[model samples]
Target: MLSLQDYSARDALDLAGLVRSGEVTAAEVRQTALVAAASVESRLAAFTEGPFEQLPAHSSGEFAGVPFVIKDLLITAVGVCGHGGSAALADAAPAEADSTLMRRFRAAGLGLLGTTKSSEFGLSVAADQKWRGPTRNPWDPQRSPGGSSGGSAALVAAGVVPVAHANDGAGSIRIPAAHTGLVGLKPSRGRVPLGPWQQELMYGNVVEFAVTRTVRDTAYLLDLVQGNAPGEKYGAPLPAEPYRDEIADRSPRQLRIAVAAHGWDGQALSPDVRNAIELTASTLADLGHVVEEASPAVDWEGFLAALTTTWCAGTAAAVVPLLKSGTDRDLFEATTVTCAEVGQALNPVDLAVAFDQYNALSQSFGSFHAQWDLWVTPTSVGPAPAIGDFDADNPQYTAAEWVRRCVVPYPTCATSNVTGGPAITLPLAQTADGLPLGVQLSADLYREDIVLRTAAQLERALPWAGRRPVVHVTTETRQR
Candidate 1:
């Protein structure tokens, strides 16, 4: 039997290749993953569900035997709890059908072990909410693993799984990915399906994708899972070629790269993040691309206010179904209830103005991209906060204060979601103190090829996949 350390050395693709060659059976791989998940569950609180009992039936896929986990947020699988980090829905009925994305994952021969925790309603950027306690960081057990998709990030970082399902609506995937030092891609809007249920989320603010250790996995998964389903209300145009093919080309492309390392609210970036951005810019220049400082000339005040309003309205809408299902409304966090109140207080005209601002930013960003092929920035304003640092249960802070506490770091994140563009985070650098520092690269709408190729270039130019976190599953010192 292979030890968990041996399994940790290989990514999902490598495991699949071993299975294909008959070197190891899928059952053996599943057992290894289950052990790792169990080993880290006490310290990391990674999965929303427990010790994956059995593998789901395999689909005809490129990665037929590899183990995987999805965040408990959006994509649903039959009999899996999709509570989405809310206490009210903790005992909700299991889903009756697999989401389109889940079907694709299974078809690719991947095994779904279970689901991971999510921020309550996918609102806060940290998993330190009232419902599921908090998803601790694998790098430092006392700190966060970034949120909404924090649980998925934690599992992937701790070597429990190579990749896991994560979705970004207001920077959920990329934020957590950055926090945990994984390759997280929030594909172009309409790139993935939101079907068998709803259309676009928050007027196209949310998108589903994954967090992985390498650019190749991100590219391959995109090729496998991206497509417009029959019922999708919106869809992005198909890529000219498969994303895998795009990243593999890696031939020197002379594109203008813009470095937008500045904070959104004019807050100064942490020393580590600042150094990482500078080093990345210089590195990109060394890679023979014209690198310079530039960012989307967005209306800071208006964008912040509008973005917050949009989220508040969406939060309100999400809770109503729970209410109709006879859930006790008082069980939710204070922030959630406050958001719903703010959302309810708004009238139609107010909502329209907010959306119109979103549209204006979208159009403006579309125009801004005409000047440069890509925009790169620090994934967060600073390092990960200690696990109970930002409290969502406190009603004392207003929404703006809440954002200031949690979101000021990842300023550039919501831009892609708002503009229908694509963005990816690479685990390229670390703080002088050894904390991971992620850098983001984003492209215009429907151009995942740009982000992937650039990320692949960065991966080669600055290799980071072998850098393991301190509190990991493979070592004897692994925390309990």
Candidate 2:
């Protein structure tokens, strides 16, 4: 019998192959995940609830029963209520039906294990939510796991499952992955469906995807879910070939890569993150790729303004639907109310101006790509901050103050979100105290394959699977 210790030893693809080969049943894998979730629930604060019941296997699906967790935000499950971490919407019924993306996840043979917590309205960066508390970092439980996808990242990092569903609007996937030592690939906007409930979100800024332990899992999942649903407002440029196949083909991976060593907003990277990126740049050079210092020229301040515009506007729309009275507004944080008001006060002329700036920012990256194949940078300015560093709900600070504090560690992240490019964060180093450190590789629009190839090469050069966090389910890690 395979002991529980053996269950988390492999990534999802490895387990799925075993499940398909009859060496282990799908139910066994799910039970292992559930036990892992239960074992570390208090310490890590990952999922709100999980239903690990075995589902009938589908012969056509690639995963064929691999256990998976979707974020309790935009995506819905049959019995799982997707409250999206809002107090006002707590009683919202279980989704009448799964979203189109969820249907694809199921069609690909992934078993629905449960739903993970999300930051309220997917608005905050830190994991803390009034609804589910914080999704504690497995690397160090007292520290924060970046969100709104923090719960999903925490579960995968702690070995509850090989991968989990996560969506990125403004660094939610990559930020959490960087903090937790996982591979977070934010595909170009429109690369994955956001539909059946929404055709576009935040003016095409949010993209749905997963964070995983291996490049292959990221690639495979991309292949599994890469397309537009019927009547999607837009679709990504279709891949020339499946992403996994692009990885397996291993075409010569030499190209000019632009590397930025400082924050866009003048925030200097901490020594640890600085060292990691410099080392990564040198390694890329050694791997036969040309490395140079460069970044796309864009209006950073204007980009921020537009992001605020769309985010606040979208929040207003989402929250307004759930509000029935003035008291119902109490169910949300003060920042939420302020953002909605600001968003609601905007006119079409104001929105048009912001969209124009957004498009200009996107084009700046487009022109820069003509000179470089990808851009490399430190994923964060420092190791994970302590949990209370970004208290969006705190009345002591305004919403803008909270957002500024939250983004200081990740000033460059939102640029990619606005530009609609593909960015991947990889764990290649650790802090002096053993916290994970990540270096990001961002490729131009529609070039996810380039980033994947670059990441795969780096993964081989500096393998991270053997390195384990201290707060793992298999064995509790001693905190520093």
Candidate 3:
């Protein structure tokens, strides 16, 4: 039998190796994960559906028998409830079939144990949904684990699972991972299929992925799931080599890395976050990489306009079907309803212009990347914020205002999503009070290799494995 402490200490790859050696049976590892999840879940509130009673049978893939959970949005598994954190869909029938990504997870030997909570319609940066009470950070219970993917991040950070599903339309994956001290990579747009149901989510602005505690876990997972489904409308160029191979070398090539300590619009960051960026810049330079102070020159106003348009329009598309199905608008949060209303008012031309802005921003970032191999910035403006910081249910805010508020503090994440590039957040820095402060590393389209190599290099330079949250499975004390 694998003890809970042993299970919590090992990454997914390690556990898989253990099972392969027959030191622990697959059932024993699953039971250990379930017990660890139970130990911390009361304080973390990290699941929409807790551990499944009828777990999937073990497989013989790369990560065979590793416990995993899916987010309650975008992706689906057959017979699983995916409400996307909305009360209205609580009674909706389970999915009839597995999604493309879900299929890949099973084929790769991951045990599908449960689904985690998400923000309503994946619209908010904080997951304190009015319908489903807040999901707390493992590091600090009073603060959030960052949202839409907050539940997944919390569970992984608390040692419930080594990694869990997370998606990013506008910082959902990276924001949560950054706050919770995990590695979150938003793959190049179209690198992973949005498939059988969606051709492209939010016109390629949204991407599906996961948050993990190590770069190797992220890399290996990407290697397993990165590809196009048959007849896909869009696809990123195939990687030159397996992403896991890219990071295995550990020694990154010396390159020009751009560093930014402030928001793209020159917004102020917390002193601790700013210092972390400076320290990371120095550290990268120490590792023999050429680091300098620079950021891509972006048209801030144009970018925001496009973000507002696409995000609202996407929300409208998802929610209007339910609205027309005669589901009461009252069943939704106020922000969701208002976003649909605003989106309904827009004509096709509005979306066309928004796409145009996305093209221009991509070109501008492309030109900038021609000079710099990577762009590094603070993942969020500061450490994890309190749970109630961004109220998704507030009716007072209009659609545009809501988008602005969400992006203002965590500005860097959406840039890669809009540009169709790859970006990752590394848990390299921390606040004096011990909360993690993630730093963002991004590259031009289809250049995940650069991001991962640099991320692996940094992980070695500043190790984060010794730190554990008070609510973690390895911790004896569980705070509520």
RMSD for each of the candidates: 1.5, 2.1, 1.4
At residue 448, what lDDT does model 1 achieve?
A: 93
lDDT of 2 by residue, 1-480 (tens): 345577677888888898889998877777777777777877887786665555545645887757889888888766678778778777777777878888888888888888888888788887888765778998988888888899999888888888899998888899999999999999988889887888888778888999999999999989988887788997887898888876674556589999989885566778888889888999999989999998888677787777778877888788776664444877887777777777778888889988999889888888999889999988899888788677767766554555566555786787788888999999988888789998999988899989998898889888999877767768841221
Query: If both were scored by lDDT, which would come out higher, candidate 1 or candidate 3?
Result: 3
lDDT of 3 by residue, 151-254 (tens): 99999988889989999998999999999999999999889888788888777888999999999999999999999888677788889999988887555579
Question: Model 2 — which ten-residue stretch has the worst lDDT?
Answer: 471-480
Q: Tens-digit lDDT track for model 1 on 182-209?
A: 9999998889898768887776799998
Where does model 3 exceed 4 Å of error?
476-480
In model 3, residue pairs whose N, Cα or C atoms come closer than 3 Å (at least 3 residues apart or on different chains), thus clashing, are none
Question: TM-score for each prediction?
Answer: 0.97, 0.96, 0.98
Top of the candidates by TM-score: 3
Question: How would the candidate models be sorted by lDDT, starting from the highest?
Answer: 3, 1, 2
The window of 10 residues in a row where model 1 has the poorest summed lDDT is 471-480
Off by over 4 Å in 1: 324-326, 476-480
* CA lDDT of each prediction against the hidden true structure: 0.85, 0.82, 0.89
